[model samples]
Target: MSAAETTTAKVPPTRPSTAQGAGGGTGGAGKPAVRRRAGGGAALPWTLLAPCLLVLLLVLGYPLARLVALSFQKFGQPQLWGFQEPESVGFANFTKILGDGEFWAVVVRTIVFAGGAVILTMVLGMLTALLLQRVSGWVKTLINIALVASWGMPIIVATAIFKWLFDTDYGVLNWLLSRLPGVDMVGHNWFASGPQGLAVIMLLVVWGAVPFVVITLSAGLTQVPKELEEAARLDGAGSWGVFRYVTLPVLKPIIVMLTTLSVIWDMGVFPQVFVMRNGHPEAEFQLLTTYSYDKAFVVNDYGGGSAIALVTVVLLLGVVAVYMRQMLKIGEVE
Candidate 1:
């Protein structure tokens, strides 16, 4: 029973420590270490996200605040903060814009244009997505490349191309129409009238927007489980039946998202119309966005422009509110 013999006897048998055993021990020595390790690991992720948060605040927050402030002021005045400053006109500008007949016309035109563009883009995009899903190899690659190429092109450049294509005289479209059977005087002035101008604008907007919808829908399509689709087919479902019952329900959320985003994008469309017709012959083809620009810059009426911008913001907010309500209802069902 000497000290050495006692120590050797006590060390004779023992169990190795485990995670649970270590944590459960009386002194709780391992718990703090475990927590520290977890906290240290979390820091990396937050560090990685820090830059993005900083950029978002710097790039988006500042400009948005300035825009809101600008909408409340008169033109040619120094802004109380950064950039321009204008006199406070209260709601006078808003009232003036609301009273203007042309403002309502532009608003209606914008809504119709955006609505039509979203519908057409969604339809075309969905069809293209389904078709592409069924194909593979080189053909799929080619299609993807073409779509991405169009999407990657600059908006101004694309509008310029469309402008040339639809030009009234000495344009390729007019030239092609001249050769068609039973068609004489084929060189129609595409932007000479409101209807024609709006149609051209719609084409441009849809063309730019369709690729985005296609990319988003195609990604969502990839997430859809193939077995469910196969099961529907095995149950004597035709293509339409399969799509209506199986695909549509599954894709509804994404479709709604794409549609909402498309509407927002088309509503703010300015460059195409501005570049194409300079707000058109008599500004008949002017949209809310272009109208705002004209009011502020063209006519040097900053107050009216601010009022127009404020109204546009309200309209957009209303659209967003409606979408949010619809989304909540959809969520409730699930």
Candidate 2:
């Protein structure tokens, strides 16, 4: 208890570090809990998605791998039935498909058909969505019911209904058109010409596609700021100007997504064309899907058919890339 001892005695001893004490004398013990939480958070989404991924791999991945393999081999009836071993032909199938004038024609026709269908679908959908925004509540509800009903209709049933509507001999569409003064649509063969036939099919495609687009656009519309729209109008923006300057920028992402999906769906149109043409699509009526189908089943050129399908997949991947780029650009703008 001298001077130094007296000073030390008066001073209180420091307690052990609270962090270490709380962590049971191990300062870094809590780190593992944080790391585990981080890891678990990262893994949770993938764990949730694993079931869907497994199903897709089983359902779509196997067929896609088989298609890729078949495209490089001679896989006709003989090989298909095990009557003969398949011969590997390297790039022969791809070369033949790329060299074919008919294949190129089908490619161009498909692009045009899909382009038209997407354009019409977007225009009609946007107009309908805007109309919904203006209509009374009950009217809007009725329109929603109609849109959902059409969207829920099975593709086969809808195709059959369209077929009857455009039937050559007995169709309500023709009867209605004939009622127009100086118009002769009775007994008109709508499927006689390829473009005309494709146009009709395109209408059917648009009809099926528009409801989803309308619903999506309408939902997106609700997210747009009414204050921003009113501010623009007060600044002397007209209807078109307000939409162009305010509304369009806000909805650009949704519009890009809808357009891309519509393109993909329209390009892969098979059931509509196949069922409409009575399962035997004419040469003029051939899109890529139908052409590949005819090549595989009708002509028994499975390799060529697979090659065409793979090319189509490449084109669709390119479209998806465009959509991704657009979304990224929109994000940057925001």
The candidate scoring highest on lDDT is: 2
- lDDT comparing candidate 1 with the true structure: 0.83
Cα lDDT, all candidates: 0.83, 0.95
Off by over 4 Å in 1: 1-50, 77-85, 278-281, 325-334
Candidate 2 scores a C-alpha RMSD against the true structure in Å of: 3.6
Candidate maximizing TM-score: 2
| Superposed Cα deviation of residue 147, candidate 2 (Å) | 0.6
Candidate 2 — what's its lDDT? 0.95
**Model 2, stretches more than 4 Å misplaced?**
1-32
Q: List pairs with backbone clashes in candidate 1.
A: 77-85, 77-86, 78-85, 79-84, 79-85
- lDDT string, candidate 2, 75-165, tens digits: 9999989999999999999999999999999999999999999999999999999989999999999999999999999999999999999
Clashes of 1: 5
